[model samples]
Target: MTPGLPMPVPAPGLPARVRIHEVGARDGLQNEQTVIPTEIKAEFVRRLAAAGLDTVEATSFVHPKWVPQLADAERLFPAVRDLAPEVRLPVLVPNERGLDRALTLGADRIAVFGSATESFAKANLNRTVDEALATFAPVVARAKEAGAHVRGYLSMCFGDPWEGPVPVPQVVRVCRALLDQGCDELSLGDTIGVATPGHVTALLTALNEAGVPTDVLGVHFHDTYGQALANTLAALQHGVTTVDASTGGLGGCPYAKSATGNLATEDLVWMLRGLGIETGVDLERLTATSVWMAERLGRPSPSRTVRALSASLGSPDSLDSHKE
Candidate 1:
């Protein structure tokens, strides 16, 4: 720690207020091979809401054939619908079919994903990038008519598994399209977790120059390469305030081979606190919850900071023993 340097300085140009949309219940559990009981999912949603997360992605309305893990989204939604009326329970809607399912379940906030990489788009959605975006127009319009807020996700913005380096123009074009399609906000996903700080700067700069306003952009990063926090700092410097992270670093891309985990929520909160940003997340509570989840899964946490902090918390006290 630097002398006289107060921890948690707010990033420049970032709004004094920032929103963190918790994805642990949905994105976090979607990748788990074990079928989390619907009750467990509901309980997790309750805990997350109680932990001061105003936005929690409760579940995805995708078909079981495509994502069997979230097959119980319909069962999960109504169970936790009234957890906190102020807390937004956004659900992922893949296409018109998924949209219909969400609407049937009375979804209020919806998210749709598109890919900046052509190869990832075909592999993940079985369509070209443009074709995938085209499918969302009707879905977005319908959701809007039904008084739902729409959020757009642009995946593989940093690099692609099959295509390698994704061009800046490609990312900007996808972002613009999503914004133009009536999405209230757009999230740029580093799906492969291959983004460096320089890559983050260049991408956000290009997107801004292309007229994608900073207020409407969010950053979703994976910690596969352990660079998520750093990349997030770059995004914050670029004036992006909203970020997506999993509770225990629990999610990964199914179509992205060899990818690891989503950025840990505990680590993001820790970094934000250290930088003087107010995430309004209870770090102690989040850290304990993360430790509990990691134990439940029988896997070590993917967050280096969380692991270190947990180790220290469990260590013997040095209060009276420090004299030696």
Candidate 2:
């Protein structure tokens, strides 16, 4: 215990609790060329829950024309409704229509996405940033009435594809607006993976100045330039807790050209454990599951740690690079 501070009461073995909202079933599977069957989606959710992820973004309740893959979200939601009672399965609602669908499916938690860049907003949401927020107001109000938890996503918080560097002021404005309107938590997304540790601190600092509580903020970063984990650590130091990570580094924003996969769960777990942060994740199990997922996707695993560990499994020398 630190000097002058009471020691924390120790239990037999208290698990370190960290909130990981898995987006693999929705964010990961959405962009694939092949339409993953609904059964597969449910099984994927079950597996993720079994792996000890307490929160999972199960699917997006959007129009079939917009995201044909998740069109059967209603069916998928019910299939996995029997998940361990402790796990939360939040779905994404793009608008009032989607929110209604989520409500119909008995969704108790939902997430909404807003953009920080006008150009990216125009391209993806077909509206200005303000317009997109306005479009979600009714959805937010309805969600609150239904007693559901709402997580807001602010995309392109660090950089924009068309506009390049996004002003910190702009990010703060959007984040404040989302909280003011009503969102339990706001996840600031480095949609393009261009954020540095400095940028992360600056943005969070600005948000703090704007009266948004740090605990209500979460970090969602991509590893396109190998900075996602770095940025995540910076955010943690900045007093921001709760992070968004995909299992096995499963997905990236398809609309953001330079964007790559999310910070690998295994990689994030490794860092958190090193810091003694207690993410409550089973690293060995998570890594093995990631390997199984990589095989299913038929692609090279995006996680460096996963690759190194896989090679280590084949030969002891392969583990040298990861040794402390």
Candidate 3:
């Protein structure tokens, strides 16, 4: 166990055990300009699982033309599928074809992406919001029928880069649509990382009123505005237990140039441990994994926790070399 930071008492209604969904291999690497080797991607997943992450998103089954970096999803899945029986490897499937490929690979867990605003929906999926949801409905149905757990991700929930502020009701409708499609959980995303703690509280409160269960809701925030951790803390206070984070703070939205990486897993673990929340993640191993990944990316980790620990542990080479 890593030494806990001195934290104030956790806010009321926070869950004792939070599930940290590691998304570095899939969501993190997809936006990279340079294509990472398949073997190294596989090793990255292996290292994440070894760091005690129970739910590590392995890869995406989207078309290679859209995300060339993850073109090797077919090969990557099998390589990391058997890393651990308890570790879940959920791949992102954009449509029926993606689902078909994932099913053929014996994937038992998968995720679908949706956007809250029309501009992003069309830009990302080349369809309107309703059309995109319609497309995901069948994919979710097929995955569920095949005994695979399906997670839905709604991007730009807080604000859209193209359309400006996204209304809460609009987000709620999409959330309801995904649940109605039989998704097991929904990961609300701050695609542009423009969300603050207030926005998180408001959106989650609206979802709760709309009958969306917090148990099946996860929060995916970007650190572009450096609010990911604060927003995560707010989500926890509202009874959300699952969180999506990337090791080494990898990933950005290809469509949204201003968007940065997802919240760093090491940073989230540091705060959760300090708050006495059990995540079943080993901070030391997780930090080391981020450093190892940074070396492979030819850049240092964007995680403060990783940098601080690496420096204190006498590995200054792991500090981020790239400017924010």
Q: For candidate 2, what is the TM-score?
A: 0.88
Steric collisions counted per model: 5, 0, 0
Model 2 segments more than 4 A misplaced: 1-17, 252-259, 312-324
lDDT (CA) per prediction: 0.82, 0.80, 0.89
- The sequence of per-residue lDDT tens digits that candidate 2 reaches over residues 175-252 is 888887789999999888999999999998888888887888888998888899989878877766588888777784
| Residue 101 of model 2, lDDT score | 87
Per-residue alpha-carbon lDDT of model 3 for 1-324, expressed as tens digits?
A: 334454636655678999999999998998788889999999999999988999999999999999999999989999989888999999999999999999999999999999999999989888999999999989999999999999999999999998888999999999999999999999999998899999899999999999987898999999988899999999999999999999978886444452347899998998898888888998888888887887877777777887878765556553444353
Higher lDDT: candidate 2 or 3?
3
Which clashing pairs does model 2 show?
none
Clashing pairs in 1: 8-274, 8-275, 8-276, 9-275, 9-276
Q: For model 1, what is the alpha-carbon lDDT of residue 157?
A: 93
Model 3 steric clash pairs = none
Q: Is candidate 1 or candidate 3 better by TM-score?
A: 3
Off by over 4 Å in 1: 1-6, 9-15, 253-260, 312-324
Query: Candidate 2: lDDT over CA atoms?
Result: 0.80
Best by TM-score: 3
For all predicted structures, in order, the TM-scores are: 0.90, 0.88, 0.93
What ordering of candidates by lDDT runs from best to worst? 3, 1, 2
lDDT by residue for model 1 (1-324), tens: 113213766656755656898888888888888887898789888877777788999999988988899999879999998787789999999999999999888889999989998899899899999899999999999999999999998999989988888888989988888889999998889888889989988988888898877888899998877799999988888878899988867786454432457888887887787777877777666666667666666665666555656664562211122222
The residue-level lDDT of candidate 3 at 320 comes to 47
